[model samples]
Target: MYSRSNNGARSHRWTATLVMGQVLLWSCAAEAEKLPHNLQIHGFASQSWLMSSDNNVFGKSSSGSGSFDFRELGLNASMRPLPRLQFSAQMLSRWAGKGSEGNIRLDYGFIDYTVFSGETSQFGIRLGRMKNPLGFYNDTRDVPFTRPSILLPQSIYFDRTRKLALAADGVHLYGERRSEMGDISFQAGVARPLVRGDEAEAAVFGQLVQGHLAPEMSYIGRVNYELDGGRIRFAASATQLNMSYSPGEGSIHFVPVIFSAQYNAERWSLTSEYAFRNLQYKNFGAMPDMDISGESYYFQGVYRLTPEWEAIARYDVLYMDSNDRQGRKWAASGTGDGRHAHNRFAKDITVGLRWNITPEFMLRAEYHHVNGTGWLSTLDNPNPADMSQRWDLFSILGSFRF
Candidate 1:
């Protein structure tokens, strides 16, 4: 006795009610799936304003107030789905203020499989995304709250970036050999190369600006020996770079030699790392500016005066064949013939004090004096021309992290 329209309306209402019920059920199940330890999350809220008499060396302008800006929000979580298998993930979100939507980037996320082989040799394969192991420092390189200095030596690694050697999606093989002197471990992996068309173009001028780990072809291997007394690392790396400008016409060879030594105890710790790299451009123009071979190193001494306070003094240096066909990062910020042979060199001295205000919080203040022509700013400006302007720099910085 019901009309067709009435029948259709009733059917539609039933479908809608069913869909709502399904959504409510899913919401409840999702809430039930979370656990205290399985869903762990932690982050830091920080504020920093650059107080400089001048602008940045890169020619970029700074916000007028020195205005307080949020540096990072970190979230770390891990789960053990099985007795021998575990997964971990970390995210670092940066808020530079203004209209910046902020970047929710994957700091690290991978699955680790433990091998009962008894030597602390865990066979793990990472699928989602992983960090590159070009050198020792690239592993634990992070920002203010964790590092003793405001800036990581640019010669090695820089801050949170989408490119220029960072988290890449691939598989990693890491294992350590145990011995009486200590445990000697090795990490090696093969993946896409670190340089593409633009990356290649930038490297020609000696400014490895950004973008590493693309689908080109790269290999990294590292060996480390750690004992209760100390630790040492020996790393060897090779990368095959392919860029768009050159097409399949040319390639790059990178041979990096790395070394690290660390001694940690109850009150004090000393850590150091050195790297020597040889970069060759193949099938390119016959120019000195096109070929590059360079070396860089850093040494740090830490004194944990107490649980509440720590102090550190560090020095780092880089030596590049300044006279290559074109200039390098130490060269003035500009376009290059890709030619130069000036024996480019840059070195800086830094002294810092860290206050462990509490278990979850820390503060840092440091001073730096650098002598070099390239992007050398003792201050926190990204522009090279703003600070150095073809001269050396004396800069200071202060930042806090949680």
Candidate 2:
């Protein structure tokens, strides 16, 4: 670990870098305003009050203590550099007061090409940092105000890369088709998993050992069908597991499957999802390996009492197949990571509120009680606790976008 002095240095460095980015963004926006024709630029910003706590119970529990948590900042911009094409990017800055944090990082940046048409789904390719559309939520992640819970479904798949995972250098093919049942769409691409830029490896990043969950190459595909009444989504992807996952570096493959179901109307709505992973290696070796598998499911109901107010409650659970025949192959080979690395499960319950202040802004609040192994099923575990289920979190956010 870096010395205490280095901690301050790193924080200072990030602050400086963040300031520089802000300056550039603002300068360009002002300059663009002077241009003529269709030149337009727009963006939004938001902040929150976060709280997390648990009563420190043991074994199993349904809910946890709640306390003040972290704060978040986000900015998004769209520039019409040309009449037929549009460009956009978003950035996020987060902090955990009193010196606790995951780290400073980049959120996303990508360019889009749109074809003008009313009856057809246009062709577009987004290049730069890209979202891994393993499921429904991953694609709609940027719009926080549109979600039910304050925190996302950490159980199914929340890769460190972004929401579950992100990729560099990718091309996406997408189109929309409509039917009496609903509107259908699809996207597929290839990308390099780069979640471990400079961070320490988890003693066990979930089922993964001490290597990247994403491989040198990964393939992604997704489908969504929506009707006036409800929607259904499915997604799948495969990546080459790192050597630690496969004794022989010759070759390896891992597939992840995700499913989501959601229903919404003016008065009420519900949503749920499940995700699983399977790993296989090319060579038959004596090295210990695990075919780690995980399952996550949740149900939520929301009642919009009035145009300006709403209430919601949700239950979520996550479990791993680490004890299964091939589960051992996925355990990390080290012992210095976070708790939940060796455990088989984690679960939680969340309650939330949404209030509309005006057409341009909204506020959200949430409370959660975490249990079991107490880590995200979709993420690598750096610390493996004694298999206790006692953690808590709370958050409130204010946002606006168009």
Candidate 3:
């Protein structure tokens, strides 16, 4: 049967990823020994198997055995040529359904110059391609060890718009101040977001259009406060991300603001984030000028069962149109079929377990009960009609880092 063949293929892919991951890890270890003390090399690899009861996630998860289409590989190096100057770069390959097909690409490459350094305070400038400081997790979202969960809360960190949020090309200024009271850190940047991809085009135009999406000038910044060495953390971030559709077409503009807070303890942690998004479309003749506001938020809790084991639970929500939370208004407006109303919003409940087998190896499993397909990748699910409003997903992942 076709289902059997598909399942077999997925199994093979999963096995292949595991073998590749081991090879890469060994390779990194070998190279690390040859590198100089000033030059440090590190990398991580993760592969995930996902299955859904009703909808697709990270590939054809709705099918018999789920999909083995989720994986991440990263290699990074940092060198300090001088005490005040450092160079860092990372190359990443990510496979997450049809939106990201595991292409090797530059994640970030930057030169950092420290203008001032004190016992408790420092200021620096970074030039070149740098990660956007959006929230607590954006800077290191791709690394399994750095993430609190297998997936960062999708409401605030939607994979659908990942390229735009991942990193930007330009200059950033950063400062840090630490005292007995707490620590304050900030990073502000002027850059151009990445906007060339099927997912990016679909997100901006509601569908892939005839023309291509081009990056334009954008600004991003984040400020954070930590108390008692991260016992408590809070942050505020904002972005003005802009892009233009070339070949004599319209333009797209996005402005989003986010607020984040977290509490950490020896045994447990609590975290929350909220975001407000504004979007506009213009100049495309038949596309009609439009303006929309969206909202997203999530609350999560993590408990450490042991030094090497942890459990996590979270609730995340996203709305395409703040005014139409239920999506009935949009359904009635007839822009599309009424059945697709579920696309306007999504509510997700997730729970997961993580086990650190070793300092460099980890295994994780998670489940998600979701209502709505608001964040589904258009490239993965080209036919919205076949999508189910409610779905159940289960996933397992193995990760290694050196």
Candidate 4:
């Protein structure tokens, strides 16, 4: 009887040990499955060579060797500590001639909290530095893979004034609604615009001033609609960016509204955007009280030759003053110099090709026939007297991502 009882006890102990081992194995599997949902990381790097016939672009491109001055590097990470909360941040270093100078800066750092989430709808808020949803590519403009060409359409995405439109410091609210017919989404924010860069100074004041420009409260918002899971998309965005100068002077304000649309298919895509900008200056003595409206627009098309090859074409135009499309009125009025009239508008025709060697690597080449110097960098072309009315630009770029 004792032997039988001892054997039965040993069997029960073995059963308990097997069950505990199974539980431990299942727990490890479950943890492994949840790893992907908890954290993620992404990054990209790119280098470009540029050459121009007459004008300088992305460094001294007119030289025989061209310019190897255009480079971009960025890294970003995101983590979800809870089902309804997330944290994200990115750092960027860009070397685009004198304008960017390859300074390492925080591109975006934000905390996102979802207040309500459902199968078909969701609402959330973000706090900290956030990318401004200005046009189709503004939010992800720095990422080379996201762009159709080596350079974005300058008419709407002017590199000269990129700092002001890149991102702002403050709060953003967003919402999304989905359905079988379509999906609609919106993002609105109240933030302080970045106004302390040389590029911003040149864009706003026409030149770098002795006194620095300071940021003030500003507002920005965008609404978007997508059909058939983004086969067709449309968006409208607007911003009221405000700023003031020191020494008890006056103020400057910029209000821009943008409309964007795109259509995508298996082999080709078409994209277009239009922007109207209103600028006003007040109370600054000796400086004329200026109120002007500018116009810009572009049409672009991309064709996919194969899974790895693509071609692109775009026509972009910008007018510093809608009323003075030819710049004659401003020239006659003598704003500063009559020769500066050529600085008031630009029209560009571009064609480019892209090759995706792999999912993580790409090479691209492009050419631009541009008329007028309206969007030329003031830092690179400090003296407008030397600029040519018409010029050509060629560029090659290689990019990698992970």
TM-score of each: 0.70, 0.73, 0.93, 0.90
lDDT of each: 0.52, 0.54, 0.87, 0.87
Location of the lowest summed lDDT over 10 successive residues in candidate 1: 1-10
Q: How accurate is candidate 4 locally (lDDT)?
A: 0.87
Model 1 gets an lDDT of 0.52
lDDT of each residue in 1-402, candidate 2, tens digit only:
221223555567457546745754684567556755544444444555654443321111113432232344455556776755666666555443222232445566677776543563555566767666766566555556655655676676442334335444466666677667677777777765553422212313333343343345666777777776354433343333232233345344556677777777768877777767665544435544445565667777888989999999888776666353222333454432443343555677888889988876889988877765534322222234533356676677887654
Best by TM-score: 3
Tens-place lDDT digits, model 1, residues 1-402: 011123334455445434433443454455457665554433444434433234332222234334343354455567887777778877665433221123455678888776555654555555556667755556655455665565566555433221446555566777766666677767677665434332233334333333332354566666776676453433454333333223334455556666767777777777777766676756544532255667777888889888898888888776655343223543454432232223245576777777777775677666555555333322233234334322222233343332
Candidate 3 residue-wise lDDT, 220-289, digit = tens: 9999999998999999999999888878677888998999999999999999999999999898777678
Error of 2 at 342 (Å): 8.5
| Model 3 stretches astray by more than 4 angstroms | 1-26, 31-34, 337-339
Q: After superposition, how far is residue 273 of candidate 3 from its true place, in Å?
A: 0.5
lDDT-wise, the better of 3 and 4 is 4
Candidate 4's residue-wise lDDT over 44-145, tens digit each? 778999999988887899887899989887777799999999999987777787777665678999999999999999999999999998989999999999
Report the C-alpha displacement of residue 237, candidate 4, in angstroms: 0.3
Model 4 ranges off by over 4 Å? 1-37
Global CA lDDT computed for model 3:
0.87
